[model samples]
Target: MDAEYQSFIKTLRAGHKPEFPADAKSIEYARLLDAQDKLSFLRANFNIPTRSPLRKRALDGTVPGAVKQLDISNGTKHVKGDAKEDAPSIYFVGNSLGAQPKCVRQYLNAQLETWASIGVNGHFTSLDNSPLTAWQDMAADCAQQSLDLVGAASASEVIYMNTLTVNLHLMMASFYRPTERRHKIIAEWKPFPSDSYAIASQLQWHGLSPSTSLVEIHPDPETMYISTEHILSVIDEHADSTALLLLPGIQYYTGQLFNIPLITSHARARGITVGWDLAHAVGNAELFLHAWDVDFAVWCTYKYLNAGPGAIAGAFVHERHHHHGHHHHSTPDPEKGVDVVGYLPRLAGWYGADKTTRFNMDKVFRPAEGAHGWQMSNPSVVDLACVRAALAVFGQTDMRALRDKAVVLTGYLEWLLMGLLKDNFGEPAFRIITPGNPLERGSHLSLLLRPGLLDRVSETLAAGGVVVDVRKPDVIRVAPVPMYCRFEDVWGFIEVLKTALEEAR
Candidate 1:
C-alpha cells in the first residue's frame, strides 16, 4: 500500500473509539443506540418489506406441502417456522435502490384521480380537491424543492429533466466546447460505463480519437483510493490542453466523496468548464453547487433520493450562463451581425422557448431564462409526482441533521465489522476500500473481500434476509441510510455477516 493510504488507515483506526462496549455484537448495545436515536421515528415513514414464508422455505431448501391445506387468517397463512408478517428485512442496499416511501402510493393515487376526473383539462387546470396544480407546472414545483438539496442560488439554475444519461448528453452538448488548443477531456480511469461511453462518443463526434483526446487518472496500484493530490496534479499537467473536467461528486463504487469546491476552483482557474455526475451524491452528501461555482451538474433521483426506478433526473447550469443577449433569430443582429457576445450553443426545443411567446409560434427562438431554457419537452407528470413525494419526506428534516446521524451510524457499522474480523479470523479477511474519514466518504462502505468469496458471502447474506449489493470480482457494498436504517439494523447485519462468512468457509 502507498504510504499515504497506510497513514490514513492508521489514523482512522486510532481516531475511532468504539461507542459501544467491546461486546458490541450483542443486541443490548444495538437497542441502546436505537433508544437514543432522534431519527428513529423517521423509519416509520417508510414501508419496509418482510420476509415471506415461501422465501424462507426456499432459502432453507424445504418444500411446502399442498397449498390448499394451509391455514389462513387475516390474509396470512400459518406455516411452520414462518417469519413474522410485519418484520422488515435488514435492508443495506440504499446506495443502489432506496426503500420505497409509504407516501409514494398516496401521491400517485392523487395524480391518477386528477387524470381520471379532469381528462385533458388536467394539463392546464387544477382539479378542485387535488393538492397538485396543473400538470404543466409539476416539473417546476419539483425543481423548487430540489434547489436546497443541490444548494443552487436560484430555482432558475436547476431543472427537473430526463434520465441521468440523457441529461448528461444535454449538458455536454452545451458545455463541452472543444477548441484546437484545448481539446482534451479529463476524467477518472474507471467512470460509470454510461459516462465513459458518453465522453468517448462526444470525442468521436468532434472527429477526435479517445486515446489522444481523453486523459484518465488512475489510482495508485497499491491503494485503490485516488488521492486528491494526484487528481490536482493531472489537472495541472494538462491545464493548457484540457477543455473540460468531468467527474462524479461521489465515486459510485468506492463511495469516496471528492472535494468538489477545491476541484471546481482549480479547473475554473485554468479556464476549463467543470461538470459533475452527482448520481450518488445528490441526497447522500451536502452540496453547494452555486457557491462552488460549478459550470454544470446532473443527477438521478432514484438512488439516495428514493424516487422510484428510472425516476426523472435533474440538472444545474450556473446563473452566469443564462445571458439572454444571444437569442436565435431569422434575421442577423443589426448591431453585431451574427456573433452575439456570451452566447451558449444549445440544442433548442419549443419547451425551452420563452413562456410569453412560446404558443405564439414565431420563427425566432427566444430561449427561456436560466436552466429551464435547456428543457426539450414536457416532463412526465407521474415521474414528477414520484419525485415530489420523495422530496416531501426530505422536507421534514434538514440535510445537516441527516448527515450528522449518518457519521455515527456508518461509523458504528465499520466498528462492528472490524471487531468481527479481529475476533473471528485474527487477520484481514477483507479490506475496506472506501475512505475511512467520515468527511471524505458518504454512507456506503465498499469491502474488498478475499478472492472468489464475494458471491458466496452475498448469497449467504441474502438467505439470512440481509440485503446488500455485490460489485463484480470481490467487492460487496453496504449502506445504512440515515433516514430509515437503525443502529440495530447495522448490528444485526454484522452478526448475520459473521455467520455468513463462517458458512462460506
Candidate 2:
C-alpha cells in the first residue's frame, strides 16, 4: 500500500478519520489530479455513454466512442457549444450499473460464433485464437480470474453461477442449518430488498417465523453509520441463538463499507456462520473472503464490474466447505438406487456434479469440490462471456491500484462537495450519508438531499450531462467508477449538482 493509504487505513482502524484535503477546490486541481493518476489510462477500456446516447430510448446503431451525426444542416458542419449534448456524460452511477467494457462486444460475438459454428462441441472444445475458454470451463475460468478481486485463497473457493439472490439462497441452504437452540439470523438494519427477501424466505422455508428468527442491527440514528463495535455488540447479544450473521460488505444505499474481517471473525468466534453480500463492495472496494475466514459471500457483477445488468453473479465458499467427501456407504442402497455420498448439503443439480461423472446418467450424486458444487445449473455461456470480458479489464490491473485511485478520487469528490455545504442564501442543501473515512466506504458517496429537491435535481443533472442515481425520499448516489470515471467527471458532477441545487431551490 502507498504510505498515504496505509496511514488512512490506520486512521480508520483507530477510528480517527480526518477530513479530506481542503485544497481540491478548483477544476484545475481536478485536472492536475487526473494528469498525475497512474490508472487514468484504464478509462479507454470502457465505453462511457455520452449525453445523447444516454437520453436515447432506442438503439440507433450507435456505440460509445463512435461518432453518430444526424440532422445536419448545410454540409453537416459541427456547431460549437451546441455539441455539448453529444459530449461524454459524467456517468456517476457505477453503483447502479457500470459503464460497459469495450471488449464485451468481441467476447459476446466470439461466444455466439462458437455456438453457431460447433454447436455441442463448443462445450468441450477450446477454439483457436479465441478470447474465451470452452463453455464447460467458463464458470471456473471466471472464478480463477476473480480470485484477486474477491481475495480467495484458490479458484475453487470462488464460483460464478446464478444471480446474487439465488447464490444467497444456495449459501443459506448449506450454511444456515439452524438447530433448536440457534434458529436466529443476525442481519444489518437494512439489506437490499433481494437479500431481505431471500433471508426471510429461507427462514419461512425452514419452518421458522421471521419475526422470531431475524435479528437486525440498527445503525446510528443520525449518520446511518453501522459501526463495527455496534455489529459486534449485536452479535454478542444474540450469540447463542444466532445461526448466521449476514451483512453487506458495503451498504448499497449508504455506500458504507463494513469491516468484513473484524465482523466475520467476531461472529465466527461465537459459533455463528458469517456471510457477506458484496453486491456493492466486490468491485468497488477491496475484499479478502478467504483470509477473513468468511463462511461465504455473494455478489453481482454489474456494479463497478463493467458487466451488463443481470450479469452472472458469484459466490465464495471457504476451502473447508468444499467437500469432495465426508462419509459414504460403499454399497448402493436398494431404496435410493445409488450409493449415498456424504458432503455439504445443497440444492444440487447435474452442473454441481463432478465433471468426470456429470454425464454418467446414473442416479448417484458426486458433488464437485469447492464453491462450484453449489451451482444448480449450467451457467449461460453468454453471461460467462460478458463476465470474462469484464474480468479481462480487471486482469490488466490489480485491486490495490483501483482501490488506491478510488480512495483519492472519492476524496476529491468529497472535498469539492464540502465547499458546497450551503447555498448562496446560507442553507444546507444536502448531507452525505456515506462515511467520510476512505477505508470505511467505497468509490461512491450517498447524499441525502433536503426534501422536495430530488426529482428536479435529478432532471437538472440529466440535462447537464451528469448521470447519477436518485434513490427516492431524497438521496442521490454519485459513483465515480475507478475503472472508467475521471477526476474531471467528479468535478463536473459537483459543478452540475451546484447548478441543479440553484435551479431546484
Candidate 3:
C-alpha cells in the first residue's frame, strides 16, 4: 500500500477519515489499489491506444475525430503509434465497443497463413501450432469456448452465427409464432433502436399492427428506470395474449441488468416465449440461459466481448427448443429454407448441414442437431478468429471471477464520482442514472450531468484522453470494464470530469 493510504487506514482504525489531501484522494491511492489487484495482469491481453494516435483515420493517418470513409467493416482497431512517448488513453467505453484483444492479430495471421499455404485444403486442415480448429468447425469451436460465458447446458445449446439483430430475426422466426388469440410481443420501453425496429418490423411482416401487438413496459418517466415489478405487471396484463417476451439482459443506455432468471420464469409460466437481447450483457454480466430456461437469446460480441465491431454474433436455443420449434408451424424466412430431416424449421445453409453428409451432395437437408441446426451461412473465418482470440482471454477466467471484479471496479468509480463532483456552490453537477444497487447493474454507470454541461464536459474529457459514451443533452456512460480497465483509470476519469464540471460552472 502507498504510505499515504497506510496512514489513512491507521487513522481509520481510530474511526475517522484522514483529513489530509494525501489520504484516499491522491492518484497514489488508486495506484496502491491497482498494485493489489489479482486481475491486473489481465489488462496486458488488450492493446490500449495511446493519446497521440487516437484520432488517426486514414491510410496515411491524417484525420482527426471526423468519421473516416475507410473500410472499418472488420471493426474498430486500436493502435499505439506514439505509445512510447505519450500516455495511454483511459478507455471507459467498453460498454459501447471493447478494446481490441492483443491475440486477435495472432489468430488472424494464423488463418491467413493456413489459407495461403493450402487453399482448398485449409478448410479441413488446422496447423498443430495454430490456436484454431479446421474452418468447418470454427463456429462450434467458438461456441464451446463460450459455453461457460453464456452458462449453456452443453456445446449443443449455443452457437455463434449472424450479428445480433439478424439472430434475433432468426430466433423470432421460430419462437414468435403468433396465433389469432396470442400474437402480442412484450418488450421494454427503451430497447436499443435496432431492437425496436426488428420487433416492429416482425409484427408488420406478420400482418399484425405494431401499434396494438407490441406491448412495451414503460419506465418511470422521471428517472427512466424500469422496475422488475413493472415488468412483471406488464407481463401479467398481457400474459394471455403475449406470444413472446424480449428484453435486453442489460439495457444498453441505462446499463440496467435485468433479473434474467426471474423475468424468464415469470413470462414463460404465462406461456410466453422468453428471448433476451444480451448485446451489452454477454461478457459484462453472469448469464444462465439454460439453467434459467430462457427460450432463446441473441447477442453481439463487439461490445464487452472485445471481438471487434461487426463480429459474428451469438445465439442460444435452449435444448428444449432444438427439435420441437416446428411443432408451432411458424413461418419460414422464405429466402433460406430447406425440408430438413430434423423436426425443427430453420433457415438452412450447406454449412449448417450435418458434417457427415454435408459433402454428400444430397437434396435432402439434414441440419446438425441442437443450436448448430440454426446456422444460416458459413461464418466469416476471420471473425471467428477474432472471437477465438477474445475467448482465449476469457478462457483464462470465468464470469464469476470477472463479475466480482466488475462490482468492485464500477463501485469504486461510483464512490469516487459521488464524493468528488462537488462544486463551489455545493450542489453536484451530475447524478448517476444507473441503479446504485450492484446486483441491478453491470460494468457501466450512466452519469446524467445537469442540463447544459454536456458539451464542455465531453470536450474536456476527450481532450484528456478519457473515452466515454456521450448521450447528447446530458448523459455519459462510463464503463470500468474489469477485463482491462484499472482503478487508476476510474480515478483519472473522475479527476477529469470533476475539473470539467468546475470549469463549466
Q: Which ten residues in a row have the lowest lDDT in candidate 3?
A: 333-342
The whole-model lDDT of each prediction reads: 0.81, 0.85, 0.82
Please give, for residues 1-505, the per-residue lDDT of candidate 1 as tens digits. 1342234334443545334456557788777777766678888777665555325532432223222432333455444554454356788888888878878877888899988988888888877766677887787778788777999988889988889999899888888867787889999988999999999999999888789999998987666788899999999999998888999998988888899999999989998889999998888888899999999999998888999899999999999888767445434332221224535667778878777777798777777778888888977889988998999888888776677667777888888888878777555678888888777788899998888788889888887778898999999999999889998999889978988788777
TM-score against native, each model: 0.89, 0.92, 0.88
Candidate 3: clashing residue pairs, number? 0
Give the alpha carbon lDDT tens digit for every residue of 1-505 in model 3.
Answer: 4564345434433333344443556788788778866688998888776576676555543222223433444654533345332577899999888998878878999999999888888789888999989998999899999888999999888899989899999888878878878899999888899999999999998999888899988888888789999999999999898889999999988888889999999988988889999998999888989999998999999999999989999999998766633333445432222223335565677777777888897677776778888887878899999999999999988997788667767766776776776424576788888887777888999989889999999999988899999998899999999999998998899888877887888
Residue 194 shift from truth in candidate 2, angstroms: 1.0
By lDDT, the better pick of 2 and 3 is 2
Error of 3 at 72 (Å): 17
Query: Model 1 segments beyond 4 Å from truth?
Result: 1-20, 53-81, 329-342
lDDT accuracy of residue 223 in candidate 1? 61
Give the better candidate number (1 or 3) by lDDT: 3
Clashes of each: 0, 0, 0
